[model samples]
Target: MEKFDNVVLNSRAKYGQFYTDPNVGRLLVSRIETAAPNSVIDLGAGLGSLSMAASKKWKSASIVSVELDNLSYFSSLKGNHFHIYADALDYDLPNKIKNEYGEFDVALCNPPYTRPLWKPEYEKILEEAGLSETRGVPKDGRAELLFLAQNLRLTKNGGELGVIVPSGIITGERSLDIRKKLLDNYCVGSVVDLPRGVFSNTEAKAHILFLKKSSPYKKNIKLYEVKKEGGV
Candidate 1:
């Protein structure tokens, strides 16, 4: 893993590819509420850490992993999971996955944290998800939110999602509409606050968001704070 990280370090800013810690990946997988999901996916899977963790937890489940980096994608192929070598934000990817694997039972991701130049395709995605009207729609794209929307689109009606996103999406005023969209359209299960430096290369505060792909319901969403790695 260290070797992989070193190889990508020089281009991390260009690709916005920061890998997730294995322990943190395990923690995110553990928080998913599903009892027995048969299919799992990791979009933006960097070296397959999150998908690898899912494989450990759900031994019988089939795993699908997608990565954009050439080296990372090839490295992930070492696992027994199906691997896709393409940009996760490609507009047609959801349909491709649907045709190939159908809607997944679970989706996990630790997406890139860069603010990319906005693309017209993103508007189409937000419209499809009924999030186009939200104030949280950024003129300059937010990669994490786009990844969240893609995860939702790829999941089954009663499926689960476990994703790591920047804390801004949880508390920023600009993200209010994104929060509202989640609360209004899905079953948010919990938000786990991870301490700084959880990722090897960045200090951006991050949170693990747990959601179920169903209409909003009246329930108390749990909140957890982890001061260090492995605390969850």
Candidate 2:
């Protein structure tokens, strides 16, 4: 594996790539109470930490880790999890794997949060994948929101998903529509806010969202504020 410092200093920051801590990965995994998911996907599976952890827990499950970076994807090759070199946003893996793997039983992700310059094609991709339609974008075009939408679209009806996202998505006015969209589709399970330093080199405050795909959306969503007293 490349030096952590080098990975952070060279490409990750620009790409908004922050690898999940092993302990944090396990914590997120524990939130998934499903007995045995037949198929699992780790979107933006940086270094495959989450995927590796999931593979260990669900020994009989089929795990697929999708990472865009070649270096990270190559490093993941050492693990037992299957790694795919492609963008989770544009690459429609769920549709492709429908015949063999069927819909994903679970999707675990720590999606990129940076607002990259999105082209018109991105909206087209989202529309094609049933994530969103071609409409006026939000005031703050958050890539993280799009990532969440894409993952929700990929997951099977009744499957679960857990994703780490910035706290702003929960509180910010810009995220109101995004939150509404989520409320419309999934049964919001739990949102556990993590401590400041969970992602090692990044300073962004994050929260892990646990959601289940349900047709009739529930009126209530659970919120958890984890204190640093116990150490995240």
Candidate 3:
């Protein structure tokens, strides 16, 4: 992992590739309520920290990691895991994975946060994925939301998702629409406000958002706050 530390730091802004702390990964996985999921997937799995944590917790599960860079690190991972080198946002990904692995029982991600300009192609992708009505899709696209949507699409109907996202997606005005979509369309399990400086280079606030891929949104979602030194 040290060999790619410099690479991760250099490409942080470009790829939104902040690696997850192992403790945080464990915390996120702990929040997921699934008992013995058959399969687990981590999209945009930089260095596979989150996937690794899931693997530790669910020893019998098959782990799947999709990453666009740092292929060598994934190549070195052992155990019942399949690592794929592909863009998580590719529109055909859902179909391809469905044919190969079917919908996953658990999905985890710490997706890229870079905001690229919105394009018709992106709109088309979301529309085709049945997320056309999803709120808070910015005119200048947010990579996090796009990745979140894709994760949701990839998860089975009753699957659980644990994701790390910027706090802006939780409270910022620009993200209001997406927040509404989550509340209306999914069972939001909880949101944990992580301590500042969780990432090595960025002080940007972030949260662990847990959701179940079901409708008739469950209310009174739990909220938590964690100190840098401890778990929630």
Among these predictions, the greatest lDDT belongs to 1
For each predicted model, how many residue pairs clash, with residues at least 3 apart or on different chains? 0, 0, 4
Q: Is candidate 1 or candidate 2 better by TM-score?
A: 1
How do the predictions measure up, each by TM-score? 0.89, 0.83, 0.88
Model 2 C-alpha lDDT per residue in residues 32-100, reported as the tens digit of each score: 968899888888888677887788788888888877777784343334467778877764556775676
Instruction: State in Å the error of residue 58, model 2.
Output: 0.8
- For all candidates in order, the CA lDDT equals 0.80, 0.73, 0.79
Off by over 4 Å in 2: 1-12, 73-80, 124-140
List, residue by residue over 1-232, the lDDT tens digit for candidate 3.
1212243345645777677877788888888899999999999888778888888889899899998886437544567788888988887788888877889999999887776567666776666444565554556666777788888888999899999988877767766767776787788888999997777566667898999888845658888999777857
lDDT of 3 at 67: 86
CA RMSD for every model? 4.7, 5.1, 4.8
Q: List the pairs of residues colliding in candidate 3.
A: 135-177, 135-178, 136-177, 136-178
Weakest ten-residue segment in model 1 by summed lDDT: 1-10
Clashes of 3: 4
* Candidate 1 collision pairs: none
* lDDT tens per residue, model 1, 1-232: 2222343355555667677888888889988878788889898888778988888888888889988887784343334478888878877888987877889999999988766678889877777765676774557767777888888788889899998988877877777888988898888889999988877776667889998888877489889999663565
